[model samples]
Target chain A: MNNNTSIIVTSEKLNLQTCYDFVKDPSCGGIALFVGTVRNHSYQKEVTLLNFSSYSSMAVKEMTKIAEQAIASFDIYKIAIHHATGDLQIGDIPVIIAVSSAHRGAAFKACEYAIDTLKETVPIWKKEHFIDGQVWVNTHP
Target chain B: MKIKVLFFGIFTDIFGKTTIELEVPSPINVVELKAFIIKNNPKSTALHFAVALGETYADDNARIHEQQVVALIPPVSGG
Candidate 1:
């Protein structure tokens, strides 16, 4: 598939190098990448691990929209967004975003926009497992 | 019209299942469907959520049809 703008929702590990390489271009001077890893804690609770679930069809569709938006809103040449589903432990990479542009400013802006928009719009959910119990993140006030 | 409702995130916990079949009147919009779900599953009312008709994020006014895939999406936390 053309890597100019890729949206992936998978149960496999995310390779950062692959994302960086996908956005690499001879004409593009700058590339920005953002990696989201499962953290060890949340709100003072010790998180043991995380389990991610997604409405796969809608998640991919929404992610594609975010990438297209980033490309249109910024002077970016390419964008890649990958997200992992299923069980994940702390330090595991769950999401990766890469954007390339002719200049550093646009690349940075696009990269940030991609991730922020994904969190807000995508149909992916994370459940944080704690010692006492597990709770779905971002579902409460 | 009969539609398939797929629940995600905490909604699955609330409904005790991932997918459910609902029979509703024809010409029902998303707002009425949501109200029906909240009426039956009161626990779902606590979370902020949205509905997706097929693969598209739907507004409250979007119409739903028979056998259409409708998903209840709770606030997402994916990075």
Candidate 2:
């Protein structure tokens, strides 16, 4: 991917503005953003918090690969994918994807593809904490 | 041959450590390495995982070598 792709995997909070600024281009007409946040409930149970961990180096490479694929398949100008690590309370942002394109359709589609592929391929894991106990979701098997 | 293996998330809890160095036969492929891991760490025998070499996922046929970083990755949920 080109330098326009901003891929970040951090324990710090994810900023929508930083991602937006990176993808914003005067040449592009539309910018699409996807923000993933922690929810209070899941599978009919209450979720108190979430813990995210990853193979950091591999996660960045996978995110870059997704961005490259988005650029290759879509008419997008730039893309930014950022994910959070460590403990996150309910409503905390876990991920943000920003895509800019000359048209709205490509931007929207690329943003979706970026996030969808990330969930499947990235080397990050999420543990949902409940008052009773906790379990890992989206087990590979 | 000594290979460095990395554990994350649940694997860390199961292994009780972040990384470990293992000695194995020289010509062991990814498949054999996985079998060795499960046999040694019986708790992981039932869980499915992907073997990663460096920044990419290594297929079963991929040859593993000494001093290489290998990660045992469970299913991902990054969003």
Fnat values, candidates in order:
0.85, 0.80
| lDDT tens digits by residue: candidate 2, B9-56 | 788877889999989888899999988888887463475788999779
The per-model DockQ list reads 0.70, 0.74
- Interface root mean square deviation of every model, in Å? 2.2, 1.5
Poorest stretch of ten by lDDT in candidate 1 chain B: B39-48
Query: Where is model 1 more than 4 Å wrong at Cα?
Result: A1-3, A139-141, B42-47
Q: Report the interface RMSD that candidate 1 achieves against the true structure, in angstroms.
A: 2.2
Give lDDT tens digits, candidate 2, residues A1-141: 479799999999999999999999899999999999999999999999999999999999999999999999999999999999999999999999999999999999999999889989999999999999998886554
Give the TM-score of each candidate: 0.94, 0.95
lDDT of 1 by residue, B1-79 (tens): 8888888998889888999888887888989888777777746356467888767879899888888988888888888
For model 2 chain B, give the 10-residue run with minimal summed lDDT. B39-48
Q: Which ten residues in a row have the lowest lDDT in candidate 2 chain A?
A: A132-141
TM-scores of the candidates, chain A only: 0.95, 0.97
Q: What residue pairs are clashing in model 2?
A: none
